[model samples]
Target: MIDRADFLARFGGVFEHSPFIAERALDVGAVALPLTAAGVHAALVAVFRKASEAEQLGVLRAHPDLAGRLAIAGELTEDSRNEQAGAGLDRLSPAEHARFTELNTAYTEKFGFPFIIAVKGLTKDDILAAFEARIGNTATAEFETAKTQVERIALLRLTAALPGE
Candidate 1:
């Protein structure tokens, strides 16, 4: 069996700042030995999905806004920093930054959570397009969409952490 501490240490940040998902996975016996990326992701996602709506919203809110204050201030978690950097979010022009900030505010005010997308393979333009498009979604639809994006982000993190999954 994998040691609990070791598992938590490796996967704790898979869901952005929500390490409690890892804790809950262990508490509820969702983790098993011989952990693969897919298995670990499934366990973590199952725990996330089973959480109350409020808890889920808290998880969503834990994420930093893309290219917003956290990114500009260098306060993003290591995974988020790397992901955003990879997507060229770190290289936005002043106008692009302003646009992102504006869209982020509008999206958050509309959906009650930061706009989220898995930025691994997307360019800044792609992200901006998605942000603009998703900003118009209804609250319920956007909430579900954000939750799905969070899951996708978790899976990407797990795959990077575990490799060869």
Candidate 2:
């Protein structure tokens, strides 16, 4: 079995800035030997899903706005930075940036959290379209959608961290 600290050190950030998911997974005996990316992701997601609504909202709120201030200021976590950059979010023109900013603000105002997506395979335009489409969803629908996106992001991160598993 991997040491608890070591496992946390490697997998903690799989859930954006929330290391508590990994910690809670370990507490619940989910970090068994012969760990695979899928297994670890499943365990962490279970804990995340089981979290209180307030705690889940905290996790969603922890996410940085896409191509927003954090990206402009170079403050996103490494995984988020790379993911956004991969989607061409780092090279937005001023008009594009303005639109993203507007949408981010509106989305946050409506949903009480930053827009979240698994950007690994999406283009900037695709993200914007999704942002616009999702903005019209009901608060209850958006909350569940954001949680599912968070899970997708975590799984992608885990796969990258544990390639070949």
Candidate 3:
């Protein structure tokens, strides 16, 4: 078991820059002291579900573009950096980096936010393929799709942060 402060401190970065999810979960008693990743995720989802569309969009936008500016500038959150590296985003050849930049620009220009995917098990090719496929989706559909991907990312991060998985 842990205190609220400890819980927030540990899991604050789980949702990129959205620590309010943790705080809200605690306030609603959705998170028990000795948290399981699933419980925490559910609580965060509950909060997300109740949020206004604008708020949800803000959360989605909070996430960095994969291998985008933040990564190049060394400004990504530790979790994001590690996740990108895990998917081989950190070691992209020159052509690969340019392709990612192009796709990222196109996706953001189209949807008004970064293209997101939970890259835990995916390769660079997989991420690129997803970017290609998802860019064709309508804005409404892409908004929903991005939110779903954020949930998947939160779950993966929560699981990794849990004491025993």
lDDT of model number 1: 0.91
RMSD of each: 0.9, 0.9, 1.5
Question: Model 2: clashing residue pairs?
Answer: none
Better of 2 and 3 by lDDT: 2
For model 2, the superposed segments whose C-alpha errors exceed 4 Å read none
Model 1, range 1-165, lDDT digits (tens) per residue? Answer: 778898889989899788999999999999887788898989999999999999999999999999999988899999999999999999999999999999999998888889999998999999999999999899999999999999999988888777445
Return the TM-score for candidate 3, rounded to 2 decimals: 0.94
| lDDT against true structure, model 3 | 0.89
Model 2 C-alpha lDDT versus the unseen true structure: 0.93
Best by lDDT: 2
lDDT of 3 by residue, 53-78 (tens): 98888888999998999999999998
* Deviation from native of the Cα of residue 152 in model 3, angstroms: 0.7
lDDT of 2 at 75: 96
Inter-residue clash pairs, candidate 1 = none
Where does candidate 1 have its weakest 10-residue lDDT segment? 156-165
Write model 2 residue lDDT over 1-165, tens digit each, in one string. 679889889988888889999999999897766787888988999999999999999999999999999998999999999999999999999999999999999999999999999998899999999999999999999999999999999989888878535
Query: Which ranking of candidates, highest TM-score first?
Result: 2, 1, 3
